[model samples]
Target: AQSVAQPEDQVNVAEGNPLTVKCTYSVSGNPYLFWYVQYPNRGLQFLLKYITGDNLVKGSYGFEAEFNKSQTSFHLKKPSALVSDSALYFCAVRDFWSGGYNKLIFGAGTRLAVHP
Candidate 1:
């Protein structure tokens, strides 16, 4: 089984400042990690993914994440935050189940607040 943990329930930042949401995971094999953002009452929107290649991967809306294998962590980061960036962020890991199905296990989620 695969599992993920998001230690922070919420992260607050002022507009135009860098923000980070932390995540950690544990999986059997090589991990497939991902990040998604959700607006109020809306489904999650894909942010970025780290399947292979460089440790750092960029994604939609100027968001990026660092995949640290040793630490088993994939933390989301942005250089500058926008007031609109305030949303709920989720960390996920793809798992291959015994039934031959691939599924995503999401973290508890972190709420980001960017005050103007």
Candidate 2:
């Protein structure tokens, strides 16, 4: 089955420091990977996605992710963390079967806490 795992329950980092949210996925064929951020009382905002080319893909809000095919990993990264960046992060995958009415499967979810 195609799925994603976010090993960390939460990640704490000081403001202005780099931040990373780890994610690993398993899929039968080429996977469509996506990163989304959710703030308090707000819907998830799309950060980025890895579709075909470019191992390194950049996304919204000064965030980016590296697609490691060998490791089957797609980790979200940011050079500097902000208090506003402290939110819930989710790693998701869409398989070939995920079309029409199919939905995106997400990880358990990771909380990012940024300390000022």
Candidate 3:
């Protein structure tokens, strides 16, 4: 049972707008999407991963993510938005019951307000 859903708790874009932080997932066999970004006290910063050949997955600062296996979704994009790209955004999968290590099943944090 792998699940992730960031149905927006907050997302406001202004500074050169073009930002989306919405993720939806529910794994059973193959699904490994990830995107993390947190800055306030700074900790979880890894902004991009789709784990199996392209569906448009780029990483780091000017983030990119689009792995839509028929809309099971993995959407995190930033064409412009900055204000230091305000923080707190996460969407994860891959928690194969902790045996494969690197366990992750998160998605309840999306607060990115890049205004001016």
Candidate 4:
């Protein structure tokens, strides 16, 4: 079964500093991983993805991730951290089931707290 893991339950960073939300995945065949951010009482917002093409994939809000096949890791990174960036982060992998039904297998969720 395909699965994702967020090693850290929470990450604390100071505002204006770089932040990283780590994610790792285990899957059969090709790997499709994604990063999303959720604010309080808000839906998950798409951040970046590593479907193919490049090892380093860029996405919204100055965020990016590097796909490392050797390590089986896809860690979300931002050069700078902001108070507004404090939220719940999730890493998901696409899962394919019988009958062509596909779904997302998400991690437990990592809470990012940026302090001023």
Clashes of each: 0, 0, 0, 0
Extract clashing residue pairs from model 1: none
Give the TM-score comparing model 1 with the true structure, all chains together. Answer: 0.95
Cα lDDT of model 3 by residue, 67-104, tens digit = 98988999999899989888899898988666776689
> What would the per-residue lDDT of candidate 1 be over residues 1-116, giving only the tens digit for each residue?
57999999999999999999999999988888999999999999999999899999999999999999999999999999999999999999988463545489999999999999
Mind sharing the TM-score for model 2? 0.95
Pitting candidate 2 against candidate 4, the one with the higher TM-score is: 2
Clashing pairs in 3: none
Local error of candidate 4 at residue 84 (angstroms) = 0.4
Q: Which residue runs of candidate 3 sit more than 4 Å off their true CA positions?
A: 1-14, 17-31, 34-51, 58-63, 66-77, 82-88, 98-104, 107-110
Q: Rate the local accuracy (lDDT) of all candidates.
A: 0.94, 0.93, 0.87, 0.91
Clashes of 3: 0
Q: Please list the residue runs of candidate 2 whose C-alpha ends up more than 4 Å from where it truly belongs after superposition.
A: 99-102
Q: Which 10-residue window in model 4 sums to the lowest lDDT?
A: 94-103
lDDT, candidate 2, at 15: 98
Task: For model 2, name the residue pairs that clash.
Answer: none
> Model 4 Cα displacement at 46 (Å)?
0.9
In candidate 3, residue 41 scores what lDDT?
A: 88
